[model samples]
Target chain A: MPKKADNSGSAGSEETLLDAAGVKRAMDHLCREIAGALPGDCPVAIIGLRSRGDELAARLIERLAEGGRGDLLHGTLDITLYRDDVSKRMIQPQVRATVIDFDLDDACVVLVDDVLHTGRTIRAAMDALMDYGRPAAVRLAVLVDRGGREMPICPDFVGKTLKLSPSDSRRVYLDLAETDGADRVYLK
Target chain B: MADKTTTTAVRRRSGRSSGFVWGRKHLLGLEDLEPAELLHVLDTAAGFKSVSTRSIKKVPALRGKVVVNLFFEDSTRTRTSFTLSAQRLSADVIDFTGKSSSVNKGETLVDTARNIEAMGVDIMVLRHAAAGAPHLLARKVGCSVVNAGDGAHEHPTQGLLDLFTIREIKKKVEGLTVAIVGDIAHSRVARSNIFALRKLGARIILVGPRTLVPDQMRQLGAEISHDLDAVLPACDVVNMLRIQFERLQSAAFPSVEEYSRLFGLHAERLRLARPDLLVLHPGPINRGLELDSAVADGPHSGILRQVTNGLAVRMAVLYLVHQAALAVNGK
Candidate 1:
C-alpha cells in the first residue's frame, strides 16, 4: 500500500510546522507502532538522539502516559565522542550530556531521532548508547524519513516519508509549541 | 664563547620536538589523544622524572611563562603538586582558592577564567565540581587549561602519573591486569585511569559496590565486579580509589560499615593479591572505608610514589605544552 500524504494539513500556514493536534496524532500513531514492536510490557526505554530527538522523546512519553503506559524510561544521548568523523572535522564539536536514568540491561529501547538520512547519526548514537549499558533490543524511530541511507538502516515508526533528489534536501522545522524553539535542519 | 655554545645547546634541546610534541591546546581528556601523542607525554614524563631527582631541581623550560591554579574544589595534593611543578619549571604561579575568590561572591566560572587570562597567564590548572568545566573554560580563555579534577569526569595529570607509576614499577603496561577498586562512579580518577590504562594495554577490572560501578563500564572494555576477592588475585596492580562520602548523600551504598566489609582492601585481602602486585591510591585515603592503613603503608603500596611521580608528570606536561605553543606560534 502507498504511504498516505501528510495532509496533516499545510505546515507553514499554521505559523509553525507542527500544531498541537497534528503532533498528538503523529505521536499517537508512533506510540502504537512502537507498542506493537515491543515485547509484552517489558520495561522499555526511549533514548532520544540529542537536541530535537530529546524533545520528541518527551512528547512520546506524554502521549504514552495518556495512552496508559506511564512506565517508559526516558533518556537523552550525546554522540559527539562516538562520531567517526570527529578527528577530521575543522570546528570543535559541541558535546552534550548523555542522561540514562535506568539500567539498560534486559530493557527494550526505542532510539528516536528527528530525521533519518545517511544513517551515520544513528550509527553514532548506537555506539554512544553502548557506552552506558547493553539494551536487550533497540528499534529506530524518526519524525521524518528523507531517504539517503548510506547504510542498511530503516526506522520502525516514521511520521512522514519524503523522497528527495540527491542534490536537494528536506528539512523539518519544529517549533517550541510542539518540539523546541530551535529552527534547525538541512540545506540543499 | 662557552655561554654562546651553552645557549645554542639549550635551544637545540628545547627546540627539537622529542616524543613530547602534543598539540598547542588544553588537555581536558585522553579521549582527544592519539596513541603517539599519549606515548609522547609518557616518554617526556620519564625524562622529567629524572630531572626531579637533581639537587637544583629547576628547569628553564617554562621560564617567563605564567601559570594560574584556579581550584573550585578544595585539594592540597593536586594544587601543591601543580604549584611546585610550575615553579620548578620557572613559571610564575597564581594560586586561587574557590572559597576566597569572587566565585564565592557570585562570579561565573568563565568570568573568573577570563580574569586570570587578563593577568597574562599562559596556563590555568583548574579543579571544579562540574564535569567538563575545564573544557568549557579552555575554549573561552586564551591560556591553556589543565584539568586538576572535574566532577566525576577526569583528572588527566593524575591519570598520567598513575600510568607513569605503573610503567615504572611494571616495566611495561601491556599484558598486565589492573584492578581499580572502590568508588568508581564518583571518581574522576577512575574515569581517567580507565582511559590511560586501556590505551597503554592494561586490562582493567572495576571492583566496587553495584551502585558505584555503573553497568556501562563493560563497554569501556572493563570487567565489572561487586566482589573484590574475585578480582584481587588476578590483578598485577591494585589501584584503590578514595571513597567519596559526599556522594553517599544519594544513598549509593547501604552504609559505610557495610562498604568497609565488602570493598575495603585490608591487609588480609592485600595478601590475597599477587605477590608482585603493587597497590596504588589517589590519596586522602579513608582509613577503614576503602582501605586499611596497614595495607596503604605496606611494602607493596606505591601511594607515595604516585605523589612524587605527580610532580614529574606535571612538569613534563608544562614543558611539552609550552614547547608545542612555541612551535605553533613560530617562536
Candidate 2:
C-alpha cells in the first residue's frame, strides 16, 4: 500500500496518490476497458517498454490470462538506441535487451508503459517497434496519463489521469511490487 | 603530447547506480581505462548483441552521425568490422585507405584527418603503422578518434571482443587464467588484451618463444612463459594472436616449423590443455602456423563468436564516443 510516503525528507513533500487497493482496482478497470476495446478475432501482442513498462506489461498479461484471453503475443522493447536526446544527455543510457521473439506481421501490438508525459518515449517506442516488423495496427496503453504531451500522440487506454500541468515542478512516480517494494502511485 | 593530456580521461568509476558514464571523447586504448570502464563497455555490448539477431539488424543510435575509417595500413577484418558496425548503428561511414587518400601524395596524417573532420565527420576509426598515430590525430582534430590498431601499441576493440567472448562463455572474467599464445613482442592484439584483461581481474600468461615473448611483459602483470605446453594445462582460455610476420624485421624465432611445434595449438597440443579450454584467435589466422584448421574450427573455439562480438563491441565503442563528443560540445 502507499503507506504515508515521507522519503522526500519533508512532511508533505511526497503524498501517496493511490494505495495498493486503489492500484488493484485501477488495474482491474484498465483490463476490462482494454478487453472491451480489443478486436475479437485479430492477433494481439502486448509489448512493453523496458525498465518499468515491461513489468507493467507482464502484469497486464497475467490479468488478461485471468480474464481467459491468454493467447496474446508478448515482448519487451528497449528504446535506448532510439532516443532523440541521447547526444544531449551527459551520461550514455544503458541499453537493455529487447526480447521480441514472435513475428509482428498483421498483429495488433499494444505498447504499454507506466507513465505518459512528454510523448517522446511513445514515439521512440513506436520507431523501435517498427524496426522489428510491420504490425497491422499499433495501440498504446499507459497506467498513468499526466498529460503534458509534446508530440501529437494519445493513449488508447489509461488507468489514471492525474492531469498534472506540464510546467508544474511536481512529479508522479509509479512503484510496482516487482521493481519497488510496494504497489502504489506517489506524487512528489 | 597535447592529445594525451586532452584525451586522457580520469580513470575513476562514477557513483551512479547503473555505473559510471563513459566520458572520453576518444577511445585511444584500454591501457588507461579502469575496470569499471571495461565492464561498462562489455555490458553495453551485451545489450547491442541482440540487434544482430533481429530481422532488421539495425539501430538508429548513431543516426546523422558520420564515422570515417581512416587507415594508414592494410587490414581486411578490422576495417570491415568497423564499417559494418557503423552501418548497423545507422551512422554514415566513409572508408579512406592510404593508397586512395591524399596521404599517399605527401599530405600529413593530421592534415588528412583535419580535412575529413571539416567534412562533418563525427568520429574517426584510425589504423596506422605508427605507434601513437591515433593519439597524435586526436590531438590535432576536433572530432572523436578511435584507435583501430596502431603499430605495436594496441587494438582496443580486439581486446574488448576477447573479453566479451570470455565473459559470455565463462560467465565471468575474474580469476581465469588466460594464455595468450604467440608473438607477444609485436602483437598489438596481445598488448591490448593484456591491458584489458589485467584490468578486468584476469591472470594472463603470455606464451611464446623466449625471443617472441619479452620478459618486459611481466611488468604489465602477466606471467611470461616460453613453453605453451606447460601454460595450456592451467589456462581456462587461450587466445592465439596471429604471428605478425609483417611486423617482424629480423628472425624472432628460428623457423615456422620450430615455432609451430612449440607454440601452435593443434589437436595433439589441444589434448594437453584442459577439456573446457576456450580458444580464440583474432582473425587472419595463420592456418597451420598459429593453430590447426581443426582446432580453429573445433567445438572449444570461440573465434567466430569473437568476430560476431567484435561488431557489438565496436558498436558500443562508437556509440559511447559519439555520446561523449556530443556532451563535450554541449549538444
The best candidate in terms of lDDT: 2
lDDT of 2 by residue, B1-331 (tens): 1122211221111111254667889999999999999998998898899899889989999888899999989999999999999999999999999999898789999989988899999999999999999999999999999999999999999999999999999999999999999988998999999999998889999999888888988999999888888879999999998898888899998899988999999999899888999999998999999999999999999999999999999999999888888878877
Candidate 1 differs from the real structure by a C-alpha RMSD in angstroms, to one decimal, of 22.4
lDDT per residue, candidate 1, A1-188, as tens digits?
A: 12323442332222234455665556667778876666665789988876568888887888777777778899887654345543332212333346776788888999998767889889878865665667888899987677878778888898766556554322343433443333333321
Give per-residue CA lDDT, model 1, range B1-331, as digits (tens).
1223332332232222231335656778876677677777777676565446544465555667899999998899999999999998778999999999999889999998898789788888999999999989977987788888999889999999998899989999989999998888888899899988888788999999888899988887888999988888899998998888876659887888998888898988776888898999999998878889898888899999999999988987776665555545544
Which whole-number lDDT from 0 to 100 does residue B96 have in model 1? 92
DockQ of 1: 0.01
Clashing pairs in model 1? none
Instruction: For each candidate, give its TM-score against the true structure.
Output: 0.60, 0.92
Model 1: residues >4 Å from true position, as ranges? A1-188, B1-20
Interface RMSD against the true structure, candidate 2 = 10.4
Off by over 4 Å in 2: A1-15, A38-40, A89-91, B1-19
lDDT by candidate, in order shown: 0.76, 0.86
Q: Supply candidate 1's per-residue lDDT for A152.
A: 82
Poorest lDDT segment (10 consecutive residues) of candidate 2 chain A? A1-10
